[model samples]
Target: MAFDSGTVSFRRYAVMGRSPREPSEKMLQTLEGMSFAPGGSGASQEVEYGWSGGRHVLDTSFSFEHNVFGEALHFALRVDTNRVPAQIRRAYQIIEDEAASLGNAAGKKGVKHAVQRRIEADLRSGRYRRSRLMPVLWDLPRAMVYAAVSPAAQEYLLNLFERTFELRLEPLSAGRLALRRMEAAGNRRSYEDAHPTRFAGGPDGEERAPEYPWVPRGDYPRDWLGNEFLVWLWHHTETEGGVVATGRGELGVVIDELLEMHCAFGETGRDVFRASGPTRMPEAVDALFSGKVPRRIGLIVESGGSQWQLTLSAESFACAGVRLPPAEQAVSPRAVFEQRIDALRDLCETIDALYEAFLKVRFAGAWDAHVAAVRRWIARAARRQGA
Candidate 1:
């Protein structure tokens, strides 16, 4: 039986510049060569160094399920020196010291060299201990890539993609994403006009304590839009009963029992307040009154009688812990994979639609009234809680 059963974390990206055509046979070969085949880039070479990739995984073809097509790539990298155990280093040092104590200078030096060589060889061969597998998803129609990993690994994968395809990877920044959504909604708002405002407050030490002490200067101003979006979602769900009609259809959204709130644009007292079980708790209301807003939130989305749970970050709009609908009975692994991916895609589409609705209201000059309603809601919740 497997021991580790932790949930997979997902991070989404809008793939730019990939050819519109489906993955051709030649393209698939290139991907395989660059990933698990020999004579590839550093990532692929590293994987081979650890586990003989060409002999093991190179024969594997990219899998397709529903509209998603992609492959899983595994590789290893050097461990951080800081992470090496002190005991391990000490043992190596002791061996070197003992070797150096031998009588003849030449003999001692030779012995020391041998010991060092042995240690290096061990390290090079032990890379499998640190290997990681990153699952990449390509949405053919949308030209998007969703990786089942953290941004740290995503960076390496982006480099790999560039090396494989000979194309640049343009990350979908918040500004760009907003522009696209606005264009899709036909809002006609200039990008500059619709762009989220950045806080100009200097270093946290300079500013006097404001009435809203909990609102901290956001880590990144560009991310303010995303944070506000999540805050707005919470308010919308609470006041509107977690269901709203979009242009296409109705969306069912709710903040699950788990909610996390942090100061959006301040440095001091940037404590993260988390609430689980009933988002309407007084503690959560007090956190808002203290000027805190959502930096990330756990969400439950229902579309067409299907439900998904995911955690969305306010900064990059990156999602994690996405639990899609269960797969229907299937006779083969491929069929099951396809069903699961289709469910995941459907869930992401629902979120995108909801976000589009938010942009329409936010940029249509109705944001102030929305903010006012949120303030009143917070006040009532706080009053009821005696905070």
Candidate 2:
């Protein structure tokens, strides 16, 4: 489970304005006063924020340990709802009993309203709650934070964060990411739909498979630009031996054995494709022909013998399931953490370089020719299958 996994999963954000040298005494006091029981009763433990990794005096024992990387504060926000099953049962029973008492006086809709009100009142009174203290890691240097909770809790944290710090929180989402890259690369052209491809399925009916067969069950908005990056990266790796020259060093990017693709503009119920292999398989290539683009991919980055393995989201560029190179002899945990952070930073920089390269190709009137070459490759692969 992500709750216990050491790997990092987080939403990114950029800090704006001048943050204080440290969380002030007033801010600390506010966090302490607002200490909330993640869940009411058995799990009700107050969590207070405290500075970690630096010299500091202890006020009360911190429920969640916060780490400091330069000016960035890294912590985890965790909410355990393991006790929710019992609470849900109790709430349902109460609603049923109240409905019995109300009879026809309160119709079905009225009873529902009453039940909702009762539950809300109970929640407010701390009679039935189910959040446990699990801290989210925050990294201030890059103005990024990681939250390992449900979307609902993430929204709550955002609100609470603004209340505590009095600064607006901007979620580092796909559109914002695209904008940042575009500005950095000096690619003034808009990519609202800079390129889109359509697919023509074969009579074999296998071609009817969804573009991305392994889409996680969610309603996440599509990341078109990210998908494009993955597709372009795939092409580069296929043709360039999984190695690209970067300003910093030679970056070796391998797509590993897992891949997922989504055709953002494809027909309903036909927008997903999944494949696994050292390189793109025929199925995956077919998905691409059908206008599918990559969403998430397992990648391995190598610089000399040191390597980092991770699954990255094309849109958010968030890294998860990271497996760093073997540790060097005996070292302190702090040293290990610092090394991990450095490796992660290196991976991010390499990805950024690749993205910048993609932008140069995409905006330099080369996209059309690239697309044509890709189409030719797809056709050749199809002909091979028929033969």
- Candidate 2 lDDT, tens digit per residue, 126-154? 55434334344445456555554454566
Clash pairs, model 1 backbone: 216-265, 216-266, 217-265, 217-266, 218-265
* Candidate 1 lDDT tens digits, 1-387: 000113335556666674444555565556545544332333222233111122222234432222223332222111111123456657866776665676433465676676556555555554323434455565556666666545565566567667767755555544446777767757545544544432212234225432223323334224456666776788778878888788659888878656676653454344444455446777677767656666677888888889888787766667777776776786775566656667767876787778777777778667767767777777777788994
Candidate topping lDDT: 1
lDDT of predicted model 1: 0.57
Q: Model 2 misses residue 244 by how many Å?
A: 2.0
- Model 1 ranges off by over 4 Å: 1-8, 18-20, 37-87, 94-119, 173-175, 183-190, 193-221, 268-278, 329-331
How well does candidate 1 match the true structure in TM-score terms?
0.75
